[model samples]
Target: MSEPESVKDLVVVDLGVGMPSAIVAKFLREMGATVWRVAPPAGDPFESIYPAYTSWHSGSRMATPDHLDELLARADVCLIGGEDHPGLEWSFEGAALIAANPRLVVLQIAGYARGFEQRAAVDLLVQARVGLAFEIFSDRPVNFACPLPTYGAAIQGLLGVGAALVERERSGRGQLVETSLQQGAGMFLSCLWMSIEDTQSVNMRNPPKDVWAPIVRCADGQYVFFVPRYNGMDKVFAAFGIDKSIGDTAKKGYFGDIDLFQRYATKFTHEELLRACWAADVAAEKVLGPGECWDDEQVRVNGTIVTEVDGRRRVGTPLTMRAVQPNSGAPRTSLPSAPEDAAPLAGVRILDFGAMVAGAYGSKLLADLGADVIKVEPLAGDIMRTASYPNFVVSNQGKRSLHLDAKAPESMDVVRRLCATANAASHNFRVGSAGRIKLDPASLRGYRPDIVAVQCFSYGASGPRAMNAGLDPLMQAYCGQAVRAGGRDNAPLWYRNLYIDYATGAIGAIAMLFGIREQLCHGNAVEAETSLLEAGLFLMSELIQCADGSFSGGPPLDYDRTGFHCTECLYQTKDGWVAIAARSDDMAARLVNVLHLQGFPENSRSWGDSERQKIAERIRSRTTHELLQQLEAADVWCEKCNENGWQSLLDDPTARAANLIVETRDPNVGALITVGPLVSFSRSRLDANRPMSVPTGGVDTREILGELGYSSTEIDNLAARKVVA
Candidate 1:
């Protein structure tokens, strides 16, 4: 392996128009790269009003005599985002051209793959390209209004680019990489996965006393969350203001059973009961709405929520990297800014062949960070364009869209041309027949050297189910999540939202970053891979029987529900509900005190034995609000489970101090809410925002083609052929 002289920044040469391209471009700029917008031949031009600048190379369109040669000659890396339109053969031609490139990189945007179908396609592409490429899959199957999932994938691509670049420094070569959507989805289903194995053990043995509590409706039309650990149970019993002995056992009388707790819960308003519980230091919380999450003290002060808008705040990045001493003599530059026009990856070029949530959202995240992502759409455009999304603007903030038929020779030619000038290209094909859209990474190298390609799908690109059609719901059922959610019952319920898909995207971003770091270490590119099944296994690791470890009798029954720890659950309250987890003895004792119970029951029953029913019957009567207040005041470990509201979040000043929201104006959408760049660099400062304006599909085609040296007449002729869609 030979290290490159230095890390050369990426230069973007956008070929299409849409939020995807804009997003990719935004990422480049944030990374302190340069951007050179390229106008395609058929776009509707309004040059004077646009803010970006472009180079004119009219004569060098895709497959033009020396187009590939010139692009590779001038650029260190090429990037691509989104996919080309259908009906156009350009995507296919582009695939071959890119496989031929020696220096270009590709980023695939397929969100989630069912089974292992996507993985197989990626493997084939890897074999064909014989160069560097990788896949990004959404954690789960998703159908949302906005492109929230795209953030996950875009961040992953940016990280991948960095890693691939580092690898190029080591091996002086590149390889193909891919991720599985099913795996991505599996990553986010951690809770459910753990429940499965727990339940399995419990099914084998039954106990008369159950400790877990369910979410119950309150009289105030609100919900409350509560949990009964040792102390909390005692507190609830004490709150009932009784020392009644259930008989049997030690010094006195006591009983442990869900029925006992139920009897007590029914006596008081949820709130009144909660106060008694809170005095005891129970783990509990009220559910919060999206906005309320921002206001959460933990969220606000923990620096986990980054605000990108005045009114919109979201979860922040949870990881960071420690910088190593430089091995080379080159001095480090200051942290890059995040401004739309002057940020890193500004001039970096990318070719996007992704669709739906996973691939598309991945590119979008990059755009937010200042990368020029060119979304090459099929004739019909990305399916998301017509998706029944509730938040369409979330993912499409900064990107450009271009429509081209990947199957058409001319369209493929266009894709080839774009790849020739891209720093990387990407694709996200699901595991089955849906993966037909993937391009060979090695083949792309034929058109340009050292190119990076990112690919994501359903299953692993190399597994048994590599070609199966997998989606979120299917993944849930297959992974044993549905079963866990249903508890003793076999009937499973699908989660209302596509959490797995989004989580996969997020994890993929982290992988991409790691891969890019490796590339920087070697003068070669590295392939990064992940799978849905692997993700599922990871999620359920706690529940799965390890090859080397013994089950040895799970948790104590007083706190366990089969495999489920019934103690960590939601509890009804007076005003609402709270989610709580009482795990320690101290916590349990505090709860008892808060409930105002004094002398211990005469019964010799241990903390979590089956002889504590008298305590259960007492706490059931209080209201959720009162319980939350009491618990919170006592510093109990708990929180509210928000079904969907934001009042509390918006009112939290701590959230504002944590930089959970930042204000920025968009060129295209005007003033709107945006989420995070959710990361904080202790050593390097980061500054970037979405662009003010984004282009629509084919909006700048003619102008871009003109720069490529295409004669006006030729440009018009191509439009007549409907080659540019």
Candidate 2:
């Protein structure tokens, strides 16, 4: 089968009900694919939930559902909102979609993949069930302001679709791809989760507070944040004539005298501190309010935020692609697709120079897809390899590792040799670091013009903050998620956790897919990249603006630790807490009937103190499960907030059976249970038993060297010279 000419040659049908399906459809359209939105007569019932949806769906091709079957039969890809559409809640729906077009890639977006598939899967409930309530919000239970699970799930679902499409070029067949809001939450915490025998990992709220960056107020009472891992912060202080001691505090992750640092920081306004930090090469950003980031200069220049023709704001697509038409007689991108029993990416090879989680996790996913990934580590390995072995293991599992001192002149030879056999290369090294070592995309293109290359940056590769260190916390502070998540208190708090890091890694994986698709379908090699800031903005895409600078987000969460009102908020039961998501009027009426209340007042997003107290009292009267059963029976979305024990989620019987979570045995760790790839392929099989390969780092240096035809003496001499390990 010949490959389609390009994304422009393909037809994508979006039958999804909400943003999760829309996000993927938008991606395909941006990539030049013909996209059509097929919806119910009511269009999208919950489209009003996001104010930005007005702009997000601007000019979208809305096709009548009367021809939905014909559209699916002729489409190259189909996106179904498995979570929002009641019709897609069962396997029969997915099976029917795939059976409609055996050559179509059917991507079903849902709230949960397994055990709770039949439940109402609201993003807030998914986050609550996944234990994000205590970690993202304050220590006490608070409704996380962002719809994070759906945002992340949208990207994960896109990844699943891209990978399946790439594999289709080889197999000439389609597969069912599934992802959920629950899995989206899992993406944020995938690498951090660990399981061995009966023990499971827990959340890391106090993870490393200093690593959160100092959230300091400016002279005008506005807030700013600095990169925690950056070492040049003291230089910024000295440039501003502040005490270098306070700067040293920042360099040490604000270890000592935080108040002193805050005092010094307050001496400068956002412009003043930002200018000084730029001059000193210290990465910093102002803590923006919801929708304020739509005007950021850095994001503006990098096109992270763009303006539609009508001047409405929109987040840029995750992929920034550069297409290069192949030279005459160049080979095609399609390789022999793995057989029916093999993983989708069985024949692909990737050379990964990703250092930390931002760098490592995406390739970790590609590796999970059955690609052959070779980790090109510095002599000491990744900077964070020792920070947490479990993290490193999760991020670099199943890959061979080679240690090289890129600074050594001899190392270039080894790198070039590996490039000859590699289809792609990835890295998250500091800005200009790759160029200094001649490993940048342009340099590698000279070695393999058809290679798929991707780079991950803290900021983007251009614009004002491009040189910033890879700081996920600072991104949260900068993009306004921290402030939004902070809710009524509005301290702009951020956790030292996976906000943009893991998602950026996932985005990087998508960038890789973009390159690979270009090579396969377009007969071109592509260069694609994204940043922590850009990824964060994508996560916060709903916080947008209109032509007149009017904010698009709904009111900020004012009544902290709860939902918009009494009917929608979480309830403390006699046992523990259960979250209630009765945002719709119907659900709210059902909830009122169940609780025996006259219902909330007509004109308030927040409950008065006394009203809240009365609601809490009524909720606490029943056990959590009893209330949950009553609520579920009434068709109200409710979920119990879980702790880290939810980490062994892959061990759930339905999940394991679906291959959404697979059981693997590692020689070093006996039985290891890990999340199967977030996406599942119905026609293809994964090497589930070997999901994890090493107990520690890969010891494949000699083996890899031998494969490259390096002789024993030469390998020994290189090792002796400290050039290779």
Return the top candidate by lDDT: 2
TM-score of each: 0.49, 0.89
Give the alpha carbon lDDT tens digit for every residue of 295-388 in model 2.
Answer: 6677787776767888777776755767766577776666664577578787888899888788988888888778888999988878665565
Residue 660 lDDT, candidate 1, scale 0-100: 28
The Cα local distance difference test for each model comes to 0.39, 0.72
Quick one: how many clashes does candidate 2 have?
0
RMSD of each: 24.9, 4.1
> Model 1: runs farther than 4 Å from truth?
1-349, 391-395, 430-438, 488-490, 518-521, 548-567, 596-620, 643-674, 682-689, 692-695, 698-715
Per-residue lDDT for 16 in model 2? 74
